[model samples]
Target: MTGSTGDFAGRRIVITGGARGLGAAFVTALAEAGARVCFGDVLHDAGAALAQQLAVQGHDVGYLPLDLARPESVSAFVEAASQRMGGIDGLVNNAAITNSGGRLAGELPVQTWDAVLDVNVRGTWLMCVAAQRWLRESGRGAIVNIASDTALWGAPRLLAYVASKGAVIAMTHSLAREFGAEDITVNAIAPGLTEVEATAYVPGDRHAYYLEGRALRRPQTPADVTGPVLFLLSGAARFVTGQLLPVNGGFVMN
Candidate 1:
């Protein structure tokens, strides 16, 4: 869509994990579309560099250090973003952790599950809660949680990651219902085996398998998912809520 047609002009957006990967792509895209972007991430160097680059390019982009696993850190990050951006017009819960234990659900250790859930599920919940309060007061907001295709189609070895993303999907629906009354839209995007540094650990065979069934016959990239995300957060999707839009290159039909 043209910049004038895009709904993000003069809007304020907050993105977690915005230092790199898909989060970085989102920040760049949103800023280019005229959204004032504030992002929080633990990668201090990368975050600072990206923020500086965007600023040099004449984009309203800010970066803050955040640790999603800590409630205090989450609160501080949200508060600072809200204060700096003059309240949030959109929130993207994109920060997550993937456990590399590679165990079956029954064989997974308690600590492994806790570690993944702490950052992926609990962190997302906290961010949403904090943003909801501000959105309620502002009377208009949009949230787009980053889910995974594995949440819909189970992954054998990544049990913890799958479970965490599944919970995110469920939470999106529940929050959408609760926040709808306050004029806030809540939804999720489930990407399938997107090309990112995090996916470097993915088995080559599994990557090939994911690509084999796609009609496009190619691995997905960060740019592949950004369009759908921009749509969901825009005025074009005002009536769309409580939905999970999968940007997985048709890897899984559902």
Candidate 2:
């Protein structure tokens, strides 16, 4: 699905790590569906370029600088995005780091672990907190946390990233319960080894493992994950919350 079904027409969405990859896909799809979106990332030039590119195409998209490792940046980004979009109705927590990848748990440095959690776990939480007020005001808010299948399958040498995502899944549950009174839905999606710039560092063997293990038997793309995200943000999933969806071609069914 291209997310151009108009399900999000007139909606205001804020996305994180949206300069490229899955985040960029989300921005593009949502804009195509008539959503006014504002996205953030630490890649300043890229973020600006993406927004400009979308603007040239007549889409209402804005880009801002954000570093999830910094709490101040998280708050500022959310507030700025809300102001620009008039308000926030949906949030996509897609920014994350894998600083501990390829290192054994015993060999993983404490600093590396801390960095991953700071960006992936604490960053996700901060974004939620920053957007909570705006989302509540929307009266029909939705949150989609980008998790990873590596966490569900226990991928070795990825302890920090996996652990952080597991925490995101748990946070989704708690946030759902806490936001339910305001009609905000919180959920997480676990995508398997999608093809993206971030995954370029992954080993060939690891890629092969995911390909061979998947029922679809093909490399996953950012588009594969975007539709599920859009659905979660749409009115269609108003009653669906506190859940984890694995969009890995059945590689790790839940």
Candidate 3:
């Protein structure tokens, strides 16, 4: 999926947590595909740098500060992005946290659990609500929620993160049904433990588990997941919604 494809030419898109890792990859891919993109992240500097870098490459991409934990921030980001792009045609809910990991479920603090849910579940919901109107108005809107394979595999010591992703998957189903009337498609991609900065905190054993368990032996990279995302947001998937596509090298076959 290079810039030459231009499948998303003239499209207006928004992405969350795009300062680095998978979000950054998504931003680059989408922009190269000729989409006018607006991406946000709590990492203000990184977000700004990424936007500038892409801009230098002749891509129409903007960066805004967004903390999904704050409803006001979510609302403001959406409004600003919409105003900047004239409207939104696609949304990628890619921001999430896994602070609850590396601890026993019973040892998880209430604050930690609450924080995870606030950003992962509640944040995702707010993004959808805020972008609803613009997406509908586009008449070709698509949403791609970033979920995790851990939710489906029941990864131990990551209860809160797992639960939050499960909610995202469930939300995809309901959102698809409701947005269907508006000609919007909502779907999810549950990626495996890919090699990204966000997952650097994960234990080596967990990484090994994923590598050893996959039908494909090679370690997963950000590029491995971007193609499916592009397809879902493209015209080819106009009729495909309420679906969960796992890009984990067949680690957990559905």
lDDT of each: 0.91, 0.92, 0.95
Candidate 3 on 16-47: residue-level lDDT in tens? 99999999999999999899999999999999
Candidate 2 stretches greater than 4 Å from native: 1-5
Residue lDDT tens for model 1, 226-254: 89898888887878899998888888886
Q: How well does each candidate superpose onto the true structure, as a TM-score?
A: 0.96, 0.97, 0.98
For candidate 2, write residues 1-254 as lDDT tens digits: 12333577789999999998899999999999889999999989989999999999999999989999999999899989998988999999999988787899999988999999999999999999899999999988889999998889999999999999999989999999999988899999999999999999999999999999999999999999988999899887888999999999989986
lDDT of model number 1: 0.91
Q: Residue 49, candidate 2: how far off, in angstroms?
A: 0.7
In model 1, which regions exceed 4 Å deviation?
Answer: 1-5
Please identify model 3 stretches exceeding 4 Å from their true place: 1-6
Q: Which 10-residue window in model 1 sums to the lowest lDDT?
A: 1-10
| Predicted structure with the largest lDDT when compared to the true one | 3
Better of 2 and 3 by lDDT: 3
